[model samples]
Target: MSDRRILPSQLERMVYETIRDEIVSGALRPGEQLVEGRLAAELGVSKTPVREALIRLQRDGLVEIAPYRGARVIVPVDDDIAEITELRVCLETFIARDIAARRPTDVLEALETSIAGSCKALADRAEEQFVDRLSDFSDILAEACGNKRMKKILGDLRSVLHFIGNSSRRIQGRAARSIAQHEAILEAIKAGDPDAAAEATAVHIRSIAEDCRKAQVPNGDGRLPGPAANAPRAKARTRARANR
Candidate 1:
């Protein structure tokens, strides 16, 4: 752990982003322990900021801290993902429809570039690059809609979804399919077919959500039995608690 002086705000942001990225990348899987002492040492910051940032993340739906137990990475279940996908379908479909009707040339071009980058990253098996490019595609669609409320909502939702397990692992030939979907959406927008574009966007998000759900454990139920020697200890508190 490197020790360096940092402002209060910077420390908090740094802690938040570090933990968030770890969760998003699945480096910290669901239900994994987040020991304050360990994290503070790793980040070279006092536990105060780390604790505060964790509380903020809990509010943001990224972590769950139970009483007497430490924070644990959250994994959305099938139901949770379905609801999220439905919300995304509604929001993004509307954006696609609007973009199609308005035909923003620059936005379309930006989306094309993102799709190309995403395809290349997928081919190279670069997970970070693929995620970044996919994000850019979403950003372009939201910006094209010209709705501040929609943009903020989508951005926040994207953050939450980032923590979900990646489905890219199962999609053996997903890059080509993803590119085709994007091309279809873009073509519809270019042709000024709002209805088709909206439908296409809805289908795309649904497919991604389904893939993510498949990667998760059955129904997202993630409980493990305690060690044989600790069976008695488990009877008292089956669930973990927040740390002091």
Candidate 2:
């Protein structure tokens, strides 16, 4: 059997995907500095690929690079969140309508499976799994929507929204509500009611936007609160300790 080893370019892409997932999953937190050396050490690669990976992430609008200051995760501003929400409302509503109109058996089954998984995750208090499965449900709809361009656009928008969603789900009662909303959308789709599916999708997107807004930092800086604000300072302290 041939060795199934990753190539250098593939390794760089792997690093990029790993970091991007962490950011979207909220494990990295917004505004956190991405130290190349640390990531390189953790991933068992040279700093070169890590640096390249950061550059790739920067191009994807997930990281910000500064001259001589290294890279940091890009925190979604209020306008960024607002614009993404609006776009998602428009695009995802259309996607839901398309899926409902088509009612492909395979796609509908996938969505149903995702919804069931999401419910179980929520019931079990598996927050991370619930979020992932919920996104999977939407992704299924998007993919089956029969519009490649819209799918690509929604995918990009959802990456940013995923971060906000990770924060929004932390609010009391939010996860249960989201699960119910997803079920509504799925039911509408199963009924092959385009209008109902679109309406359900719109409601769900609006609720998510509202929850994210409520969770926004109150410091007038339009940034995510809590860990996002503290991450930079925490990184600085870690660096100081390392130097000492």
Top candidate by lDDT: 2
- Give the per-residue lDDT digits (tens) of candidate 2, residues 1-244: 9977667777776667677777766667678899999887766667888899899888777789999999998866778778878888899899888888889999988987988998898788675577779889778888787788988887766667777776676456777788889889989988999999999999998898787777665556754555311123334334433432
Each candidate structure's count of clashing pairs: 7, 0
Local distance difference test, each candidate? 0.71, 0.76
**Once superposed on the true structure, which residue ranges of model 2 sit more than 4 Å away at CA?**
1-5, 218-244
User: Residue 157 in candidate 1 has what lDDT?
Assistant: 73
Cα deviation of 239, candidate 2, in Å: 24
Q: How high is each candidate's TM-score?
A: 0.82, 0.82
* Per-residue lDDT of model 1, residues 147-177, tens digit only: 8999889887766765542433344444466
> Model 2, clash count?
0
Instruction: Report the C-alpha displacement of residue 198, candidate 2, in angstroms.
Output: 1.3
Q: For residue 95, give model 2's deviation from the true position in Å.
A: 1.3
lDDT, residue 111, model 2 = 82
Give candidate 2's TM-score: 0.82
